[model samples]
Structure formats: C-alpha cells, structure tokens
Target chain A: MYPWIWRHLPGPLPVRILEAVVLVAGVVALLMFVVFPWAEPKLPFNNVTTPQ
Target chain B: MDPPTEVIAPVDDYDDEYEDYDDEYYEDDDYYDDEDEQPAPPPDSTARKTVRTIGELLITAGLVILLFVVYEVYVTDLISAGKQDDATQALDDQWSSNTVATDPQREVKYDLLDGQAFAKMYIPVFGPDYKFSVVEGTTDKDLEIGPGHYKGTALPGEPGNFSVAGHRVGKGAPFNDLDLLNSCDAIVVETQTQWFVYRVLPMAGEAAGWAEKQANPKCAKVSPLGAPYDKTVGQEIVLPTQGEVISQVPHFTGEVPAAQQAALMTLTTCHPRFSDRQRLIVHAVLTMSYPKAPDFVPEEMKES
Candidate 1:
C-alpha cells in the first residue's frame, strides 16, 4: 500500500519516498497526540473510580 | 591456402577482433539474461502484498475496537446488574434481621464494611421504578453494585450534605437520568426504619440565599415542602471541583456552617453521558420524613 501510494505521488522516486515517509509520520503523530486523546474520554472504559 | 601451414596473424589484428566481440556481448540484454536465467518478480505483486498486509492490520484493529465496545457497554452492565441484585438482597436481609444501628442524636449510624449495602434510593422524578441500592463506599468495586455514598459524608436523613456518586453510562447507570430531575423533584432515601425525602434545589446561585438561611437558627421554619418551586430554566450548569459541591451548604461563600437543623443531599454522576470530563451534580434539601411502617409511600411517588 505504501509503495502504491508512493508510486502515485507526483514526484521523482527519491522525492516520492520522502513524501510517503512524511505522510506516514504525520498520520502517526496525529493519532498519538490528537485523535486518541480526544477519543479516550468519549470511550466508556476509564471512568470507573478506584481509590486514588 | 598455403596447405594449412602454421600462419600466425598479427597480435594487433587479434586484439581488435576481440574488442569488437566484447562490445557486442556487453550491449546485448539477452546475453546477460542467459547467464543468470532467473525471471524478476513483477512490480505489481510487491504492491499487492503490501496492500493485503495493510488490509489485515486494519481488520484486526477494527475487531479490537469492537471487543472494547462490547466489554464497555454490555459486559460491564451485566456484571453491575448482578452485583446490584446481590446488594439489594443483603440490604433486605440486614433490615429483616434488625442488624442496623440507630441513634436518637444522629438518626442512623452506618458502620458498614466497604462495598456493603446500607440504604436504598428512590428518585420519583426518573420514574416510579427508579430505585437503587446505596452502597457504602465510592470505590469502583462498591459502585459496581449500585450508587455509592461518599465516605465521611453525612448518611441518609442527616442534617448535612449526604453525597453519593454513580456512573452515568456503564455499571448499571444508576444516575443515568439525573439530568432529567427538575427543581423540587423528590429524591427519597430509605433506611431500615425511616424514609427521608429530599427535594432538588433551584439552579446554582439560587442556593446562596438558602445557605444563609441554613446558617441562621431563626430560619428553621423555611421548609422545602408545599408547592413545587418554579422550574427555573436556562440556568448555567455549574461543575464544581471535587468536594466543592458536597459541602454542607453547596457553594457556600460564608463560613461553612455545622450540620444541624436542615438536611441536604448531593447526587453526582459523570457529565454529558458516556464521558467523565465533568460532573453533573444535583443538590437537594430534606423536605419531610416518615416512619417505614404501614406501607408508607410519599406523595411525590404517588403522583403521576
């Protein structure tokens, strides 16, 4: 899939590889920093209270 | 020619002939292919492999999320509902066996083990069938059984704030409809011998005057009974920090007064349903009391 995406990217081989790397990294960062945090509270797993 | 005699060509002639042959061999793609004789894999196959792997990964992630949803929504409710039944039975047994301690000075004293069933709560505003066993502690294990009373807070029918907490979505969702409770709606707490009726207060700042009234002994006659207070709409909801809403007089700006003449109640649950970002709170003052004998039901419960 990544190679297919890279092939479709509008660049030479080296530039396309770089762009794919950057795109993957951006997606991972978004999931880590923004998406998961926003979604965690909306999920119903962590609200149970134990003595803290 | 010359009868096959040993006739040697010049070395330069031989070298030029060899050089020509080498150039032809180097430029011919077929010559190199014939040497190694292995066909290269198609580029599309590599792309297909990657796509298949990614598809599998996504399916696995989707399954994991589904499992979590099942555990959160269904499994937890099943477990909590079973625990609630057990708690209700235990409370009944305790009541029948006459094991509960009563104090003339304090109304009732609950020296209960953690997670023990102590009382029952009935909210007429939610519906006639809205009742839950009140557990002793607010820990996760205790709350799994039902709504949990905050430790060190006043017990049911006491003069101070008797605070309790329950889950809004999972774990039987005892307080799921707490937001629907309106001003002056009844939240009745039943002990072994008495039933204490508490009425929800009006919005946030409206309690400021009531707090002052509670502090002065002369305002004892200002009871919460009689006609229901007007349901003040569009009041801004207040999300106080932990321990702030459960104070003897909620949001009391003056010195915290002692719990004496007036009894108050605080019910807390997670806000916005299925999210614990903030707390949804309801504060009520005790309006009336009655003995448990002769099948006494409050007027609020009797109302349609």
Candidate 2:
C-alpha cells in the first residue's frame, strides 16, 4: 500500500522516500502538538469524574 | 521490383502478418492508455456503492476510535504529567520562598483557585516514586493538573475529612492504584509546612461502626463492628449517590450527635479501573503529623 503511494508520488526514488518521511513526521507532529490537544477536552474519558 | 517478381513469390503474406502484429500491439497499447486515462468504471448498482460507502465509513469509525483511545490513554497522560510537574515545581517554589508557615497549629489555606496546587499526596504502598500534587478543585480542568482537593473539605491535618478526587485511568491516573491500599497503610498528605499521615480504615460495617465511634465516643467501647484492630483492611465500592464517603467520618450515614474530631482523608476515584459506573472510596484516619524540617522524612517514605 505504501509502495503504491510512493509510485504515485511525483519524484525519484530518493525524493519519494524523503517526501514520505517528511509527510509522516508532519502528520505525527500535527497529531501530537495540535490535533490531540484540541481533541483531548472533547473526549469522553477524562471528563468522567463528576464535580462534587 | 521486376527482378524480385521473377525470383520470388509476392511478400504480401509476410506484410499481412506484420500488419496484423502491428494492429494487435496498437490495440493493446490503446487499452492500457484508456485504463490510465479513465480507470475501471464505477459499479452499476446503487446498493454496491452504498456498501462501499458503508465500508469506508466503518474504516473511518475504527480509525476515530483508535485515535480517541490514543488521546485518552496516552496523550492525556502526557499532558497531565506535564501539568503535574508544573504544579509540583510551583508548590516547591512556594515552600522554599517561606510563603507557608511551619507552625503546627496554623492551617494554611488557599483561595481555592482551580488548577492551583495546594498539597502533595503520597501513598506508601505505591512506593516512594508515587507522589502527586493535589490541586484545589475536582473539576476536569483542575484534575487534569493532578489529584484535586475537594473544596470545602477539611485541609490536611485538620479535624475533619480532607477529601480528594483524581482520575483512575487518565489525566496521569493519580489514584489509579487506590484499590491497592491495605488497611493501616500510610497515605501522607504534605502541606507547605507539615506532613499529615493517615491510615486506611476498614471497609463496610466495621468502617461504619468505626465512624460511629469516632462521632460518638461513647460507642467506641461497645460497638459490634469487631474486626480486630489489626485487620481493618477492606475494600468498598459505592455509587455516586454515596456522597457521605467523604464526610468527616466516612460511612456515618446519619447526623453526628456530637462534633467530629478525627482528622481523616478520603480518596475517591472511578471504580472498575477505567469505568465511571461507580466510585472507589478509601477512608483513612490521621495517625500522626509533624512539622516539616530540613532533614525530616516519614518512616513510610523510607521503606521499600
């Protein structure tokens, strides 16, 4: 599946690999720094404790 | 041409075969080119398309559930751990600045700011590394910082129940192992100036009788709740309706006939580890307290 994406990417082999790495790192950074923090409060788990 | 005609038969057969091969090659190339241009046709049936849509939706749903779990189990812990460290550092700074007095009689009280650290809690059974900063409120925002001290409850070392609430499965799970506490285990609460050590009490009927005795000193000698003094360790699960678990005397369902004097601590967390269906309550009575000095450490903290 990843190879298919690599083949579709508009670059040579080395450039495609580098692009994939950069893409993956960008996704992880977004999730860790932005998406997760934004979605954390909206999640149901931590808010379970009712205020007394 | 005339010389070839005299020497050999017409090469029409060979030319026809070559033309046929060329036509076949061109047709195959056209087929591939068409595929590249317009892929396979979509399924003709609406039902098939709907099924594909449903499959995509299910995959998306699965991914969302996975991300939610990641957010709950890992991301929240990471964020809360950072918050806990910040709160601990702030508390340490406040202590070092001599903002809190060391007088044993003086009870330091904060203005009940949300997410503000007010105390530090240590459970000896959880080992030396198990310490959490206790913040000022039980709201989600406050608990995300650490275990939150229930506002209006007695402060640590005071003559009433100092109740605290923390998440059992997320937000660093400060009270994740509350159920592991055995009877007589020390749950030490440290304010800026003192360490208040409380011992876990018995569960259920014995706990109720113990509270009754504490509330009414006359009942201490004749209570039927006789689980020997050495065996008060028991576990109890209660629903959210049982708010009295945090009362000055835990399990005392009725109004006390006299003023309560025992300094107690109640740690409450969601029961069944990760579920919020019920509450797990650990009631402990203050056993000893001492003023914080430069080199003083509790014996419980020193043990393995």
Candidate 3:
C-alpha cells in the first residue's frame, strides 16, 4: 500500500519525500489537535475525575 | 484498489524494480509483485498476497496504537502545560487588575466563570516549582488546564469542603504526586488577596486522630475539627460513587444546610496512577489564613 502511494505521489523523488514529510506532519497535527482530543474522553485512563 | 487499476496497474511495472522501492520502505509490496513473475499463477500465490496484505494492515494498526500512546503520554502533557500556563497568566492579569475595588472587606471574589482560575494551589512536598492553577469547574476540559474545583463546593478558606479534582497521570497531572503528602503537610492556596494554608488531617480512619496530631509542633497551626469532619482522613481511597466525599462534611451524607461546618479542602485524583477504578482522595483542613502582601510567600511553599 505504501509503495503504491509512493508511485502515485505527484512529484520527483525529493519532492515526493518532502511531500511525504509534510503529509505525515499534517496527519500528526490533525490527530494531536483534532481527532485525538475528540477521542480522548472515549478511551480509558484519561478520566481523572469521577464518573469517568 | 480494483477501481484504481488504471492508475495502479502501471505500478506493477515499477514493482519489477522492487529493490528501488524496497530501498525506500515498500519491502512488503515486493512480495505481492513476486507472484506476477511467472506467467501462470502459483497455487498458493493468492493466499500469500492475502497474508502480506493482512500483515501490512496489522503493522499500520500497531503504528497507530503507538502514536495514540505518544499522544496520550507526552503530547497531552505538553498541550496541557501550555494551557495551564495560559490560565495562570489569565489569573495573574485578573488578580492584578482588581485595583478599583469597592468594599475592602471583600478581598477575594468568589463569582468565577466556568474554567476560570480563581486560586493557585501549591503542594510543598512536590518541590519548589509545584504549583497549579485551581480552575472553577471539574469538567475534563477544565481539569485539562489545571486542578479544577468542583462546582458548588466551598471556595478557598470557606466553612465547607473546598473540594478539587485533578488528573493523576496526564493533562498536566497536578495531583500526580498526591501520595507523597503525609499527616500535617501543608497545601497552600493563594487567592486574589489572601493565602489560605490547609494541612492534611490525621489518617486514623476516624476523627479521634486530630487530638494526637495537634500535639505535634509541626502540626501546631493545623487545627482540630469538630464531630463529623474529624472522620475525614488525610488520604483515603474510595469508590468514585462516593459523592459524599465532596459534601459539606465528607462521608457525612447529609443534606446541604447553611449551618456552620468545618473549613476543609479535598483533592481528588485517579487511584493507582493511570487507572480510574477508584479515587485517591486527600482531605486537608484550613489551619490558617492571612492577607496576601506583595512581598509575602507562603512558608509551606519553601518546604523541600
């Protein structure tokens, strides 16, 4: 699956590497700021207060 | 994948030089391309592709779970520390801007908005840097910024339980080291105009321990409480269902009345570190309170 993604990335090798880095960074940011914050309460071990 | 065959089918040609891609990171994809080497299909080729695909999926799943742990343990602490700093800055601004006051008798204001920080808590045993802003609400969002005071509970230095809640592990875990507190240790709370010093009560599992605690020189400032509140221990692990722990008199289980009550403070966090199965409750009573002067710092804050 990663190979297919690499083959289809719309750039040369260096550009593709940079794009991959940016893409990974974007995903990390999204998870850190948006998705993970939303999903934190649903997961165990985050409930520090009662009725967790 | 089949719908994108027009785009993906051409990748099989690239997969012929799989070493180039394998040198990068697509080592798993080389196995799928291995099947197309012979003109006709091998009997187990399809099974091989299925296994490889499942393996790739499992690897992705493992990476995702690892990322989640990183987010929970480190990233959340970083984020919450920044937020708690912002809250502290806001509190400082709020406290400094109260120069245009009306009644001098009213030192600290009690009417605070949700998530607004009203006081700062210091656990001396945690270190000289051990300080946390005590926010108004105990919601997950509120505690994310700092230790949160339960709504409707007594404010700092009041005649009822000034109960607070904080995280034990992450989200700037203000009470993470709560277990370190012992009998007669001080928990100082600084409001806008006054500093209230509360000490952990004797942990005899009953009210009878206060008389003995008061005899100690270190506990000289730590006052003894009357009937119901004397049962409150310095530290107790109780089920989360015990809302009475934050009541007017902890463990008393009585209706909210305006009668005179003990001036106590309770700090609660999850027990056993990361688990929320039970709550580790630490109760302290207000032993002394004095006006906050510009040059004054609480003595408890200097304890190593």
Best by DockQ, which number? 3
lDDT of 3 at B118: 88
How high is each candidate's TM-score? Answer: 0.63, 0.71, 0.81
The ten-residue window of minimal lDDT in model 1 chain A covers: A43-52
- lDDT of candidate 3? 0.81
Collision count of model 1? 0
Which stretches of candidate 1 lie above 4 Å from their native place? A1-52, B1-47, B99-107, B204-242, B253-261
lDDT of 2 by residue, B1-304 (tens): 6998855555777788899999999999999998999888766697976777788779866876687677777888988899999989988887787654856566675645778897898887788899999999888788889998888888888877788889888679888888887665678888877788787765545654465445542222222223122222245677877776676555554554324456667788888776667888777777778878888987756543
Residues A1-52, candidate 3, lDDT per residue (tens digit)? 6766788899788999998899889978887789888998987675656532
Indicate the TM-score of model 3: 0.81
Q: Compute fnat per model.
A: 0.09, 0.16, 0.54
Name model 3 segments beyond 4 Å from true.
A10-12, B1-44, B100-103, B205-216, B223-226, B255-259
Overall local distance difference test of candidate 2: 0.73
Q: Could you give candidate 1's per-residue lDDT for residues B82-110 as a string of tens digits?
A: 99999899889888876443434554556
Task: Report the poorest 10 consecutive residues by lDDT, candidate 1 chain B.
Answer: B227-236
Write the candidate numbers in order of decreasing lDDT: 3, 2, 1
For residue B251, give model 2's deviation from the true position in Å.
Answer: 4.4
